[model samples]
Target: MLDVRASLGECPVWCSNDQSLYWVDISAPSLNRFDPATAINTAWKMPESIGSFTLRKAGGFVAALRSGFWLIDRDGRLERKLIDAPYDSTHHRFNDGRADAQGRFWAGSMNEKRDANTARLYRLDPNLKLSAMIDDIMISNGLAFSPDGRILYHADTPSRTVHAYDFDETAGTLSNRRIFIRFEAENDRPDGAAVDREGCYWSALYRGGKVVRISPGGTLVGEYELPAQCPTMCAFGGPDLRTLFVTSARQMRDPEELARLPQSGGIFAMRVETPGLPEPRFAG
Candidate 1:
């Protein structure tokens, strides 16, 4: 684990071009990068809560902040807003998101109060157009696409259910939404996730403190426990792409738990046999 930590660490992305790891601290509202070679850590403050982000094919990054999707330059500058947030920021904010293999940016909203079904999943096209993909979400997390781009997986954290949809890659449309896997316990709520080259899903079980590798057919294949009380997300990094890095949460956790797990907010890594697919760049 890296010595650095965050209150709410999530949305880990491996920039193979740079051979570094990029992630965000939702509570800290900052973007951070870690380079293993030099053991260096860097961060840039965000104006608002950043739920998630993706690298643009051309340059810089596209991020889903509380305000909306915006372009971020290398020097940590906001170039411009692609579009205003679809929902009211007073009660909601962007959460987990990523770019599909086709370069479509997909981000889902999170309901702050967890009372109403006001959340929705959004897709930003290459032309900068925005559209809704799904709705009635309590907490949107675990957004991932299959290796072939023919399947889409998402989850509602509070619902403890991870769902899969038949994806029309050509049109970027979804159909046949079905329960991919439903957690039977409250602590096993699914959070952020990523897919491997073998077309399998690996999800970070939030309070359950473990990452689960599920088959394409939604069968549990493997489970790896963590030292933290909450594992927020996981992504593949390193040159060989065999290292699985996981982010965790230290914010809002009990004091006793924090003391027991001093590395709660720190990033942890492990080696895996199956490699992960490269993070897709935003086409827009």
Candidate 2:
């Protein structure tokens, strides 16, 4: 229900306990929350770009900022620096990420140059330990997990493909990696995504102007087109978790594209027949 124009809108999260929706503006470098009941919007300026975050069980947020991962207070103030930037900030910065079911934070970096393969995916354990997972990635995006937590979904935007990995939920290990989807169009790429209770993967196809739902078997089942060409991400909200909230991006968009879709960076919502799985809270 939020129409706030973000330069680069991403990471729409539903905090059911608080009955609020949270999201981020990477180019604006801010964190925002909205209350549908009161139509109140709250924002906090971040020190650097924030790619993604997860709600904490202790009533705050654990986020992946360009500088590194940090614990943020409820009022959106920095509470603790969980860890320093693991990669060289001059060439790399955090792009997209989220938390796993085991309470471990997962974030990946992107090469600002766009052509370098000097990037990797990292995981922050509950104890605040950092470890690199996938390496040599370019423009990492679309981080998500399947409903049963048995599959981990990720994407390398430059390659225009989404990958599915056989996951070991208990150990947080990924194997048997396979191509979940590949775009034949050079401009169509996967961005952010979430899973539904039916075990279907809903992907926000950036520049494709639609959110596509694919069955667990990797079959395209449904597609919802949007006004914006760059829908960054989507998450389910509302009491029954049947409302799907989508965030789009206007940053770095061409002027002609922005003119056609005036509300390029605004947040939109739609009611869905199936309820989405609840986003998990970080135990640490």
Candidate 3:
């Protein structure tokens, strides 16, 4: 059985080199690191909301803030600003993001009120230049890349579909968009995802209390149920890459719902049969 604890955790990532699992508590403005071997957890607080983050090449992390991306140290130190993604017409904020195989950082934006198509997907290159990868999205959320780096998966919350794109590894471009999977009727919405070595995608359902395994062809293969309803994102970690770490949210639940699901905002864990790919590094 998987045992872990986190409140309002949003981005769950695995650091293979360190054999540690790192994630963020968005509403609480904190970052947590769990060492499975020591069975100990460490946390650091930040002054602002953090949408997502990833391991850096040298050390530390690249974090997404409400207005831009910044380099941060392990002690919650602000190294420097990298990119700015401010929306004028909407109260949109950065949500989920990850790095591609080439190290380019990609993330999506979403409206705080869940209204309008102001959210967008952005790509930041090593040169520190930012550009729109996709635009006019309702609520840009999770992201994933295929094993061969030929396919990219994205989700727009309102549409409730994870869309796939034909990706060009050399050019860093996307085309041929199509629906990858449609969530089951009662499964809230698809939030975040991670792709495995076999090209299967594991996605977290926002209000369903489950992490689903969907094949490359968009077929449902399995489901890992959780005690929380707002599972946000998931990533595989460990020496053998068999451990699955998940993040959850507590923003939208009511009192009655919270009473029944006290673990609603905590980070969760499980062991999966298949191992996952190393999280791609951000080129910038």
Candidate 4:
């Protein structure tokens, strides 16, 4: 575990080139890099809350911050604004996201109020054009692509539903949306997720204190219990990509609960039998 104790840790992206993990603490409004070899972590403060980010092929990162899409350098400096916030920043902010295999960055927004469905998903092309894709979402969270890059999986946390879409990699479009998985537990909401080499979807269950692996057909295959109650996201890392890294949250927890789970916001890891695909970098 990399025990930085973040307020709300999310988006754990592995950098195979450096063998380090890049992640964000949304509530802390910072970007962080963790070196497992030395147990050292470095952080870059952001001007505002940053939801998610993907490494750019050209260098640095393309981030989804409170204001909108922005290009951030390796040192966390905001280099350029890619687009303005399409939704009202006061009520919504970009949340979970990543770059597809074709190099297009896709991100989804969340309604902070949790009382309305005003959030939407967006796609940023390599040419720098931004387009809205899905709408009427409440808490956009899980975002991952199949190993073959032919299917996209997404989840609406508040609704406890994960959806699959037929992806047209060449055109960067989604169609034939259908339910991939649905949680029946009232408190178990699907959060951030990742797909393994075998096409199994691994999802972090927020408030459920566990991570679940579901086959491509939507059957639950395995479960990994976590000490933290609010695990926000998971990523595949390590030299062999067999290490599953999970990020959690400490914000808005009861004092008693925080006392029980001292590493509530720390990053956790476990070895897995299957490896994960390398994260795709933004072509832009």
On TM-score, the leading prediction is: 4
User: Number of clashing pairs, model 2?
Assistant: 0
- Report the Cα lDDT for candidate 3: 0.82
After best superposition, candidate 2 residue 146: deviation in angstroms?
A: 1.5
Candidate 4 CA-lDDT value: 0.94
Per-residue alpha-carbon lDDT of candidate 2 for residues 1-284, written as tens digits (9 for 90 to 100): 56687899999899988999999998899999989899888989998989888899888999999889999999999998889988889878898888888889898888998868888889889899899888879888888898889999999988988999998989988899899988788767888888899988888889999999989888999999998998999999999999999999888889999899988898989999999988888878
Candidate 4 has a TM-score of 0.99
Superposition TM-score, candidate 3 onto the true structure: 0.94
Q: lDDT scores for all predictions? A: 0.92, 0.89, 0.82, 0.94
Clash statistics: count for each candidate: 0, 0, 4, 0
Give TM-scores for every candidate, taking all chains together and pairing residue i with residue i: 0.98, 0.97, 0.94, 0.99
How are the candidates ranked when ordered by TM-score, highest leading? 4, 1, 2, 3
lDDT ranking from best candidate downward: 4, 1, 2, 3
> Mind giving the per-residue lDDT tens digits that candidate 4 earns over 1-284?
88788999999999998999999999889999999999999999999999999999999999999998999998889999988988999889989999998899999999999999999889999998989888889998899999988999999998999999999989988899999999999979999999999999999999999999999999999999998999999999999999999999999999999999989999999999999989999999
The Cα error of candidate 1 at residue 116, in Å, is 1.2
Q: For residues 161-235, write the lDDT of model 3, one tens digit per residue.
A: 899999998788999999999875666698988988899999898888889999988999998888888899999
Relative to the unseen true structure, what is the C-alpha lDDT of residue 124 in candidate 3, on a scale of 0 to 100? 78
